[model samples]
Target: MTLYQKLKASGNPQAVAQITISLLESHSVKETAKILGVTPRWVYKLRERFRLSNGDISACIKKRGPKFRMPNRTPEHIENLVVTLAKETNLGSKRLALFIKNTFNIQLSPFTIRNIRRRYGIHCRKHKTLTGSRRFATDFSAFEPLQLWQIDAKHIADQSALPPEAYASIFKNKLPPFQFTAIDIKTRLRFIAYADSLDFKNGLTFMLLVAAWLRAFGVKHQLFFQTDNGAEFGGSAGSRKRKLIQKLIFDHWNVSLLNIPERNKETNCFVERSHRTDDEEFYALNLKKVTSRTSFLKMAQNWILYFNYRRPHFGKNMNGMTPVEALKFYRCFYHPAIGSMPVVVLDQLSNYTSLLFDISSLPWDNLPRNKKLLNETMAHYRHSIFSTSL
Candidate 1:
């Protein structure tokens, strides 16, 4: 390649301009053009710019495009609005455009929104792209709302998800240490409950509460709860205790407990993914403000309400609708109550039940009970029981 061609190929405009200026001092314009692989007229223009700018090599660099902004460019105010909304919502270009159009009656295209985001250094988080085979492998189109729910537990004291003060406050204030989460695959509708412990009793209580909440809303379909093979849900495969727990759920509530394959988390991806959202959008933002168990529960309830009824989701099956909106979109297949399921404190419910009936009176022969968990639960509720008696 020619010297100029090589300089240009280096993708450095400053280097190209300096080299062209250095060569112009010793070589004729025609000879310079020949060596630099350029027209004599182009060389003459660079020399003139160089002389006009008092021998500044930067002047020799060709300026591309129009000197003035395009008349059709987005208005400054509109671009500012897009940037503000992008920061506030962290929505992608397409969704931001749609939101802008719907909220403000503006007609900005996604391309324009994308450019504004790029210019402002605002970026949306990019999710991993699923392979075509894996993408189409599990078809959820045929699933109806309330048919399949993915349930999982999230440790709320995680440092990665909570601020330092919030993490410390979790222990200092004696807040619930675990969050039990359940999300429907069809509508992305979710329910959450907080607990002080991560034991079989709490897990069973969470499922029972969720099932009862759904049924109260007039849901008639037989529901399925998919969970990981965590000891909380049930022990690993072939454990007799796991079978009995599954049988208990089936017999009492007609809700089937399905365990994901051993060591394969992808099967419970729906609820697993929602845990990250809880960390980013819910816990991290509000946990720092929590001062007590009651305040934390209230904050959690508000977050769940906003998530189900107000926040828009752009997941694979959601199509940019909030969970309630998605449910409404499939109104024919969903009960209205499914959209408004309440969040509860699992420990409180378990404690309330324990107060009503002696723990030993219930069926416990077949299931292996944790003595430490049982004693801790009773002791935790002992104060409430004494207060109620007084």
Candidate 2:
């Protein structure tokens, strides 16, 4: 039979391999058996011996070449490549693999890359499944915006560690600078700022700043300020700094101060969420190292602006409006008579418009000046004013 008929009858490459060995035995029993690593009797039992096909016997033989130790890329090299990609792209392994192949001429399987990255501590989700029953201290989703705010402080590096000197300093004094942040649960707007020191003075200053921000937004509703039991937030110590925040909330707006259990930062998860958002958006972004306090403050201000005005929050309670828009709407509700007038009518109140008051982002130092002016104005309007409180 022709090699075509032989190949067709063989069924597949394995059959071809076995038959080819059997046919070679008739040419030289010892040599064929040695090459095929089989007994001559076994080769003869196949019933086709010394039968060389006229055409393409070489094609039926397996192709020969040096196979790669790693067909695509080494696991070590792929791991290094994935880490580099994650730091640069902040993307998952599948997209990162495609990017590496397209951008760097390196090929890697997504599954392998994912395992490598996860082994190296790259993960998007913050929480993992619990093996035991998990207990929640509070129902976080129970309230709307302006009802509650979660506050916390996270430590960050003063500057990026570069190399030998940086590595040395990191080992010697590894603690990062402090960033105090607050998140309005209802609106999900993050108010973040940094300070040189996280002492009592700075803590009080932070509360004052927050109070000023709330005043600027003209939020009149009572609020609940939740915080972890940090010394800065006046844990069981009942420090003056803690009292200041409480006093400001109680005296100014009648807001409540609620402290999370000691060491249980998750109870105030909204603040942690804000911190994570800052880490992903600002810390992970390619920015110059914060060399000076001034530079850090500037970057922080920019981040807060983005948080308040630009970020598209996942929470749908805000009617698709950003935090700034929600603040504006909240102000309208706080003063319905003035807000009831159409913008065109209120446009005439341009100079004296109640809406002119900023409800957020106000500087703390300016609040006292505002209060003094407000008192004087209220005295002037006392005879004509109809309301009990201004």
Best by TM-score: 1
RMSD of 1: 9.9
Query: How would you encode candidate 2's per-residue C-alpha lDDT over 1-390 as one tens digit per residue?
Result: 645246547657556455555556466755655555567664453334224443443434444565555565456766786787787667666656766776889877778778777768886532222335343454546865556878777765534322333323422443235677777776676666555456544454455456556665576666777777666666643555456546544566566778776766667766775665665566545233555444555666666776676554545456446676675665534432211111111112222322433313333232565898899888878855756554
RMSD of 2: 16.6
lDDT digits (tens) for residues 246-312 of candidate 1 = 6644556778778788867777878877887877677666777878878887888888888887777
Candidate 2 pairs with clashing backbones: 145-186, 216-358, 216-359, 217-358, 217-359, 217-360, 218-359
Compared to the true structure, candidate 2 yields what TM-score? 0.48
